[model samples]
Target: MVYTISAPPHKKQRITFSSINRAKILTLLPVSLISIYFFGLPALGILLAGILAAVATEYGIQMIFKQDVTIKDGHAAMIGLMLALLTPPEAPLWLPVVGSFIAISIGKHAFGGIGSYIFNPVLVAWVFIRSAWSDPMTPLSIPHIGQFSDLLLEPGAGLLVGVSPIALLAGLYLIYKRYVEWRVPLLFFLTVFFFNQIIAFVSEIVTLVQEGVLNPLLYLATMFTFLELTEELSFAMVGVVIFGIIFLATDSPTTPVTKQGRLIYGVVCGLLVSIYGLFGNYVDGTLYGIFLANGVASFVEARTIPASFSQESVLERSYNRVMEKIPSALKFEVISDD
Candidate 1:
């Protein structure tokens, strides 16, 4: 038995930069595969162009900064792939390539290289291109998958109507591997439901008021009927929101590390996304939501910081902060024409 003993098993490398990057790639593969399958050559071209440009940008920027190259970590490539996937299928190849460069230079390098970046680099580039060249960046078409419905409520407008098994599986995989915390996503979906209901109820109320009906039960029926009709196709059911929550919003370096802090972060992001989508006329609010969430992470995290002698748990501390700010925020100001 001693002679037949096998060599000691190799120690599993715990979560590291490399593992995190690889997990992200795996999580996104399903989306990429499906896009390429449906969109054919154009999708492939955009994906390749973005990846090539990102790698080139990463290499060039590293040289410029005279920093040790970290392209092998696969982060640049991941960003490139995500950028391509997010771009409109009809977008000029140059758009993705340029976006890839900005993703590398401004989004990554400018923030002190890989792990130090404050926000999701892919989203940073997305916010830039979508703002500057809104035409090309906006999604033009949903690819036709044989008999599969394009799921468009109206041409080039409305929430998606189908659940994406690919995205769902990938997201589940990420959660299973513990690459992302469950609470961030769990709280996110909860807030999305709560927030969406509020928006839906309000919108229905306005419509009923305009149509001249004061019956609450009738209003409830009308609202529920409308919700039932489109519930399967609303923004919450759409693939993009699910995909973004799992992949983009859960970036380790960018999101809060504290367990309770993540809940607040997710809630804020989800609520904002709902507001933007329902009220602000944005096609997809997930992108902007994550960008804004990461930007304001400092404030969210600050509330969860453990006090030296204070008995406050995470929620207590955050609650105190909110209470402390309410008076100042609610203070009235009147301007006099002197």
Candidate 2:
């Protein structure tokens, strides 16, 4: 018997598109179930519609192009699942179906499919649908916590009504240990908090001044009392910002790879979110902010990638630079026996 083996250690890579997508699906499964728990059967229906549409769209596109089928890895399904999470629970049946088609056709296939796309497919669909049909995508007109006067004023209450706390915890864990960089999510939440506190303080200050009671001596105390510590916690804890940072902005192909670049991306995206939430008409601006950040990710990556030496004489310059700092070390001659 003759065996056509090339080498002793003939091993293939353990990582692949299928594995990546599988991990993503598993990670987001809890969040999806949680959403269904809060929103009931309607959420499930929308989710199913999104999945079927995405899969059909990918298969249809492949057929048109006469290319190999690309639906085996669950990439399309993941996109669909993400879209379902982002979409309004009461969205029309055709909304997810159309959004999934556009997400697959234009967001993925237009950029040569999957890894080549410049932005997350679900986010692309979000922008498309939001611009076309504004009302359906917006938050519910009814307040979720109207009875509770303290929590009623939270901006995200309508959108994330009855959202579970575990979803947020799971999302944080997912991003912390995922294959992609963690700084994007970490910095994003941090920046959001920083801005939240700043805005809350400014609002309180403006109110105090308007009421003719702005006290410079007790400004710090006023800031501590009326600032973000208690005001936005409900909004932040509820699903959207945490979910967006972990699952949406942390996309491996779309987000910056370098640590510094990812930091910049996260900060900018978080800043945009704060601006839109506080000033813009929208209660949640993650979709717009992430889409905008994706548009400029390449620019951030170019400037923030760490400096690396060429393969040739890689550490020679480093050794020289170190030796230059120590005159006594330069006097010693080192000879290599090899």
Candidate 3:
């Protein structure tokens, strides 16, 4: 009797939505829920406007460029909505629409859309909108679920001002799960905290001279160290860190593949965030920092890969070798010794 072994038939792997991608989408739900719970119908309106604007812009651009419409990806629209929600409640309705248009049309689709954008789309929108409408974008006191007078008394009322502890925890979980890069957020927060501490120390010294003793700076610092570091920081800032970890800095098309390059990219982003916080007029420095880092990241990535990999012959040979290994691995043989 003759024995024969045959390899299994080749089957193309179908691309399906991954659990991580689904989890990312689900993560957005919590923030959205919080916004709706606190800010009510207007928040929802802004979110919807931004989403619609982003989708329409994407579709229109694709049609004009003769590219396949990929609006179903849902990433761009979601980003636009999140950005809108992060903005001040008093922000003109047209600003969200315009910002969403800029985010999708220029920040994202112009660069190749979806994963190709170097900066976070939402961050980009935030920067542009804030710059265009500085007054309304700064902050507003609006009615939240439980507080009426607190809204009137506080500086940035109605609008969600401080970071959400719940959202931050969720973000950290995503980082631990490898859904987002841990380095970007960790580095950014540390850098910001350190810079703010230095600023506070100087301010304290100034107050000591004026009043002959330490003033509010010391108290503020203690509070910051205990609470505000994690809570008082703006959600826009948190969003920037989260966006950098999961979206902007991790973008395969815009970011470097090598570990060293990624490290440099993350550090540059951290530094930019610190600088923007200190020098930039916008309270949310994260967006500006991300935009700057994205430019740097793009440059870094272009120089990362070797020229050898770009050659067609080398790539083809490598592809052939990988394909040839599939059949031999499936065969089973037994050896008998006397």
Candidate 4:
């Protein structure tokens, strides 16, 4: 006689709303704290105002549309707060509030809420604000440890613009532990770094004999790698790399679902950013490049590949499809998975 005991079927773990919200708040808090410490109360105030505006806007939109408000999702409001912190301190408080409204009401909701937006909401707001008010967006003064004299001692002193490292690291850690791909950030930063080095080399050669000529590439690289790369003030390049990989590139709605598609998407964003920096006069071109790439990725996804295809084939098919769609356009394709 043979007897066997049957085990119960596995049940999926449900993440409660409270846990999700708590996690979001914890993720955002580190950046907020760092911003307050370095940039002082004004930056903190802007962040708070943006969060309030984002939450209010999201609620109002949900009410009007008769949809469930996912303030618990924490993405919309957090994006707004991040956008606000990224802006220059002297920016009018109203701009960030407006940006929050634009980000949620138009960028996120108008496209079909959370996962529907074709671009990063924070990037959308940043581009809008920068275009609308170019002057005030530029850094006017360096953030210091409560002393103006420090500016004289520090060579790279400038008001830190962009996300804090601590916040970025925490956010990325959570995201990566959830199994998000790391390639997006790696490709993006590597592309930027490579192009930046080229720009630096050329500029250095051009200005070798000139006196007091500051290297724009070095300055910009430092800024991009430090503040723009992460969510808080820290020296860990890993945080920057992780943020770019997970947060910037793993935008599920905007990014391609396939690994190959994502790699292409990341590469395009990196190239566009490099081009923007090399040619465009705007300082915030990286954000714009990402926004544009997001749109392109979405368009490519909707038209290019069949749902049943393998990831590699889908990427190959997308390349052919894109080429077919625009004969005159340059064609870029993935040759191998490795």
Q: Which candidate wins on TM-score?
A: 1
- Tens-digit lDDT track of model 1 for 277-335: 76553335777887888988778787777766758777686678877778765856688
- In angstroms, how far off is 338's CA in candidate 3? 57
For each candidate, how many residue pairs have backbone atoms clashing (under 3 Å)?
0, 0, 2, 6
Segments of candidate 4 deviating more than 4 angstroms: 1-25, 141-167, 198-246, 280-283, 299-338
Task: Give the CA lDDT, 0 to 100, for residue 30 in model 3.
Answer: 65
Candidate 4 lDDT, tens digit per residue, 72-149? 777666677667756766676887898899888888888887667878887777778778887876666433222223
Candidate 2 residue lDDT tens string, 57-175: 99999999998997999999989887877777778879989999999999999998867899888889978997898798876742222223423233333343224444445555555
Give candidate 3's total backbone clashes: 2
What's the TM-score of every candidate structure?
A: 0.79, 0.78, 0.65, 0.67
Report RMSD (Å) for each prediction in the order shown.
Answer: 9.3, 7.3, 13.0, 9.6
Clashing pairs in 2: none
Worst 10 residues of 4 by lDDT: 231-240
